[model samples]
Target: MRLVPTPEQRELRDAVRSFLAAASPMPAVRRAMESEPGHDPEVYRRLTGELGLTGLTVPEERGGTGAGHAELAVVLEETGAALLPGPFLATTLAAILLTETGEKEILAGVAAGTTTATVVLDGNRALNGAEADVVLTIDGDRVLARTDGERRPLRTLDPTRRQALVEPGGEVAAVSAAGIARARDLFAVAVAAEQLGVLRASLEAIVAYSRIRVAFNRVIGSYQAVKHRLADMHCTLEQAESIVRYAAWAADEAPAELPGAAALAQAYLGRACFEVASGSLLLHGGIGFTWEHDAHLYYKRAKADEVLLGPPRVHRARLADLLEL
Candidate 1:
């Protein structure tokens, strides 16, 4: 029911932000994007081993820190802001699905960061599947571990996050349909949290730029046109934060509400994030269009995220169906 982060959650957020500032800076992100694996292995190792981030949401019995979605949301937001490259999101999604299906051994490896995984969604595609140690596919009520599947890397808009086409094969276990749905709802909400982070970072960047940039012998931020757009961006950022938090809270405390909350989060946030990100780029003037600027990176990430979960319209349709509208 609480939309705001708790004190512990705030502390977690600050710690994560600090860690990312040092470990996943813009230079590091750029370097990782050009690398073969598309991520820095040493950074991943420090994140899991030092921060124990991989196990934040896993139960204590399952070799995790036993935190819930709220905590996970805190970490994910920081990762999104940093444009962190690696299998972190993919691994987290797999661990969550495995938890629902009672796949303890794989869950153990995921929690320990010894294994990375990705879920094969529609189109037989998976995020980070190229480097994943496990490929999971949800079929009817069963969650399968595709041991024999082939993974082919796909070029994507955001180089920081890799995608792959997977030929799903092999079956590991059976789980309830309800469990699968719940895990997916959690996944949807998690993506929303990341989008919110992108929105936040985009807004901050533009605002900072407006103050320093000169136009017509005056600070650009003082202009009526630029000021209005900044106001709009701030409004969108605030709304997105609220929606994403509600979805995360529902995922942890209100399973019955999570499906609708997740859908609503995606329906609104997917477009909103893209708007703010694009607006930020445009507001940055000529420099934003250049490859040297970080604005383009966030812009690409926002656009890619809009379709990361099957597009905003798909979520909107699901929300309408959930409401029986």
Candidate 2:
């Protein structure tokens, strides 16, 4: 597939890149990671309010930018490149699900950057835990959940996006159960797209490092072993990109192939991202292990995101089911 983004999409991408370059540079990212919350809320507000990124997929009727998943994918790709740390993926995914199901009240705060919400698709059996004002749960074919805030500490590798254990017991809005399954599948695909960005950034960092780091009077990149490793990374990165693009396009244009495509993208990209990030770190040698280096940050995030929505094994199984294998 050509995957040619529209002019508007290109503009959005460039704008986001420029904004991050100035506001959330690598130094800022490192500073936030070491801070108490591990993120700067002010930076997030600027992203939503100034850049209008928080409302990318929101409906115009509900005070959103009214963009779609394709646009969101572009934003996420940039976020990954910048190694943005926050509740962006969680909040965006939650907002998308809520808006799609006619939950308009939630939009006002989310779009305004007042409400910070994240989907709890991590270790818990439930949809999301105490942090959410609303929980969307899938039971068989029925989608049911209530509003309540129950919080618990989670051991997380990526402090950029905090995790919570939420259990809400209150009035719940019920949607068509079938739709819940579809929404979960779509969210999985969106996550895979984001992971592709991380993978790409990691690969680029490795290549840049190899070209500069010298060993025995020659750049390490000139070594056949290093060259071969980079070759494999490129192959995996391209493959991951192919599936992510296909999944995003399928979500927006080809709904019939969505479920299968989403599963394929998630399974492949999740594993491939881990490999790429890990390789990037290894290729950087000891510096990658240090706190000052940016390589470990990407490695941590890649591992975190791989299990964010679901594990690779789970998605692989879903792909098999979708294909009737």
Candidate 3:
């Protein structure tokens, strides 16, 4: 099958890249990382209002842009490249879940960029502990809890996206278990697609750096040792891309294939992306170790995203079970 993105998808990717270059350049990312909240609300407002990015995947009837997973994937890839701060991924996933479940009010706010939500997949895997206006949980069924403000900071490798701990304080709206499963699955596919973007950009950055930096009066990239390492990184990224595309397609069309595809993408891309980012940092030598270098920023994001939904090893084991291997 042809794995290339369509012309429209390519255009979407270019548009997102262009916007990020101007609104959230490398320096902006660094500054945001150091600032409180670790994100610029102004930039987010521009992206959501002007670019209509916040509603890319919501249905058109709900004030959304009426796009699909493929289109959302393009936005994610650019976000990874620029390390754009804010809860874009979290809010996007949350919106997808709410829209899929027919949570009209939540989806409407998401489309309007008024309500920001995030998933709490770490620690307890309980949604009630997720700090949001509404917390989606699955306990024999899916439930939405409206709670009081309770947020605690989480120490993270990626400072751009913050995490927190929350507690349920009041009653919640309950929904069917099937809906919860569907929402979780969609979130998994989106997260995997985002990881693919992170892996690809990390690979490209490292390859470009290796080809230019000279050692002993010769380009390091010319050395067999450096070339081989880069070759491996490229191979891993391609494999990750394959799985990511498959997952995105499955999420959009093949319902039966989503679980396996999600597991496969998360398994391969999660570990591979981290390796690629870390390897890029190492290829930069001492400079990569410094906070001033952008390599570490990608590295931190890779590490954080790897465990966002679940770790590579967990997904790999799940894949093994799904395939009955």
Candidate 4:
């Protein structure tokens, strides 16, 4: 498998990074977290209408660009790094389910960014469910769609993304168990890629702080304790990057291998990201623990993401099951 991103992918990454750098900086993230919709509609519009990212993994006939998971992974990495707060991730996750179940009408709206959605996996709670135009619930051997749902907001570790308890009250449809499982694996890879972004951002923040912050007449980065921790975080970042990339590639190229790849990615990345983000917070000293600092936000995001689909331990158990050991 190729370990490097192709030139086109690199360009895509750069474009997304640049757009986020300008539109969704840390201050913007803070604002978005407090906004009623929980995100910037202008930014979402630009991402979907201008950049056409929501359509990255969707098929051409489905009103998408027909790109594969590799490309989607790149965009998600940028979004994660920026700590983008919205239904973008939720919408994308919904897209995966729609694609798997062949839900053409809603999928087209999702691809065009006109319709937002979230999947209810935990019976009642769903990520970004409050603002979603479409709510999909998996009922035994079927996927149900509801335009109107009894949605009540729920408190969450990450306020950047809203969660709600939904009672879907609309149409019923059929979906295969195999399709659901495949969609789940693809979902794992997508979230892993995003966690990888949080990991990278946390490391960069601490490293930058270490250079400027002085302690005992020297930069903290010069100390062995700080340097060692930074090194460990870097190593963790590298491993998470590899696993996420391989899993994303598997989604596009090797369907049979995707299940295992997806499991490994989440198993490693979930914990690795939380550790690095927590480290970033700790290393920033008293300032990091404060609400005003951006470190806490990243830390919260890492923790939230770790449990969003399930924790690392859960994925580890899944990995063991996949290996039949």
The best candidate by lDDT is 4
Error of 3 at 158 (Å): 1.4
Off by over 4 Å in 3: 124-135, 169-173
lDDT (0 to 1) per candidate:
0.89, 0.77, 0.76, 0.90
Model 4 segments more than 4 A misplaced? none
Residue range 30-55, candidate 2, lDDT tens digits: 88867766677789889978877778
Query: If ranked by TM-score, best first, what sequence of candidates would result?
Result: 4, 1, 3, 2
List where candidate 2 sits over 4 angstroms from the true fold: 123-148
**lDDT of model 2 at residue 162?**
60
lDDT of 3 at 106: 72
RMSD of every candidate to native, in Å, equals: 1.1, 2.3, 2.3, 1.0
Worst 10-residue stretch by lDDT in candidate 4?
167-176
Put down candidate 3 lDDT per residue, 92-190, tens digits, no spaces: 877877776676777788788877766556543322133345544444455444445666666766776777675533323455666676677777778
Could you tell me the TM-score of candidate 2? 0.92
Residue 257 accuracy (lDDT) in model 2: 84
Single out the weakest 10-residue window by summed lDDT for candidate 3.
123-132
Scored against the true structure, residue 8 in model 4 reaches a CA lDDT of 96
- Could you estimate the TM-score for every candidate? 0.98, 0.92, 0.93, 0.98
TM-score of 1: 0.98
